[model samples]
Target: MVQNPARRTALADAAIEVLAREGARGLTFRAVDVQAGVPKGTASNYFSNRDHLLDQTARYIHERLTPDPVMIAELLRAPRDRDLVKALVRDIFRRISEDRAGYVALLELRLEATRRPELRARLTEAVRDELDANVAYHLGQGLPGDRETVVVLYLAMTGLILEQLTLPEVLGTDGLTALIDAIVERIVPAA
Candidate 1:
C-alpha cells in the first residue's frame, strides 16, 4: 500500500483524541477510524497493528506540542532573565492547557509504557530528545538554566502539568499559573 503521510497523521491525531477521551483501553483502530471519520479498516490499512498505531500517536503528540517557531523567535529577541523564564514556561503551560486532550493521551501513553517495554524505550528516547532540544533552545536564546536545570525543570513541570490537566481539584481551581511561577522561581529563578 502506498504511504499517505497526511492521512496517516489524521488517523494518529484522531487516535490521540480517542486515547484522551477513552484512554489507553479505548484506543482501537475502529475507534480511530470512527473518530477520524474514515471508512472502517482505514487505520489498519496504514498501521500494521496496535503498537504501530500507538507509536504513531506518540509521534503525533510530540509534533503537535513542540514550541512554536515564531514564538521561539520572539523569545530569542527578548532579554535573557527570569521574566523571560516565566514567559517561556507560561507559554508552554498555556499550550498544554489548550491541548488538554493530547496531553491526556500522553499521560495514558506513559501508563501504557510500563506494561510494554518497547513503548517504554520509545517514549523514553522521545522525552530525552525533547529535553535535549529544549536545553539547546534555551541556550540558543540565552535563556536562564543549563541543561541540568532544564532537565529538572522539565521533570517538575511534567508533574505540574499532569495534576493541572487531570486533577485540577487537587491543585485547586484557577491557580496553576501561580504554581508555574513558583516552580520557575525555585528552579530557574531570576537570571
Candidate 2:
C-alpha cells in the first residue's frame, strides 16, 4: 500500500485529540474521520484496524517524548551535577505541562494495551528503551548506582506528576520541584 504521509499525519493528529477528549473508550473510526476532516473510509484506508491506528499513535507519541541528540548533548554538557538533574526535571515538567492531553492519551494507551499483546509489547519495549537510555546517560557521567538511581528518580517524577494532575491543590509545581530536588540530592550526593 502506498503510504500517504499527509493522511497518516492527519489521522494521527485526530487520534490524539479523540483520545485526549474522550479517552480510549471513545476512540472510533467515525470519530477520527470527523476529527480529521476525512471520510471514514479514508481513515480506515490508512489504518485498516483500530489496533493499527492506536499502535501508530503510540509510536507518534513515543517519538515526541524521546529526547533528541541535541537535548542529550545539552544535558550531558551542563556545568554541575545539580544543574543536570534540574535540567532533566525541568524538561520533564515542561513536557508534562505543555502536552497534558498527550500524556493522558498515553496513559490511556498503556491501559488499553494491557489487553492487546502486540501493543503491550511495543509500549513496554519503548518504555524500557527510554529508561535504559536514561540510566546509561547518568552512568556515563559517573553518577553512582546510575541504573537504580534512574529507576527511582523516574518513578518519583512520574508519581509526582500523576499526583499533581489528580490533585492540583495538594501538589503544586513548586512543591513538585522541591520533591524532585530532594530526590536528586539523595541520588547525586554533594561533591
RMSD of each: 1.4, 2.3
TM-score for each prediction?
0.94, 0.86
lDDT of each: 0.88, 0.78
1-191: candidate 1 lDDT, tens digit per residue: 53998898888889999999998988999999999999999999999989988888898899898889899779767789887888888999988988999899999999999999999999999988888888998788777778888888889998988888988889885777788888889999567
lDDT of 1: 0.88
**Candidate 2 per-residue lDDT over residues 1-191, each given as its tens digit:** 43999888888888888998898889888888899998657778888788888888988877666566788677767654665776777678777767776777788898888888998998899889888988887777765455776798888888877777657788666666677778778766543
Best by TM-score: 1
Q: How accurate is candidate 2 locally (lDDT)?
A: 0.78
* TM-score of candidate 2 against the unseen true structure: 0.86
Off by over 4 Å in 1: none
Candidate 1, 59: how far from true, in Å?
Answer: 0.8
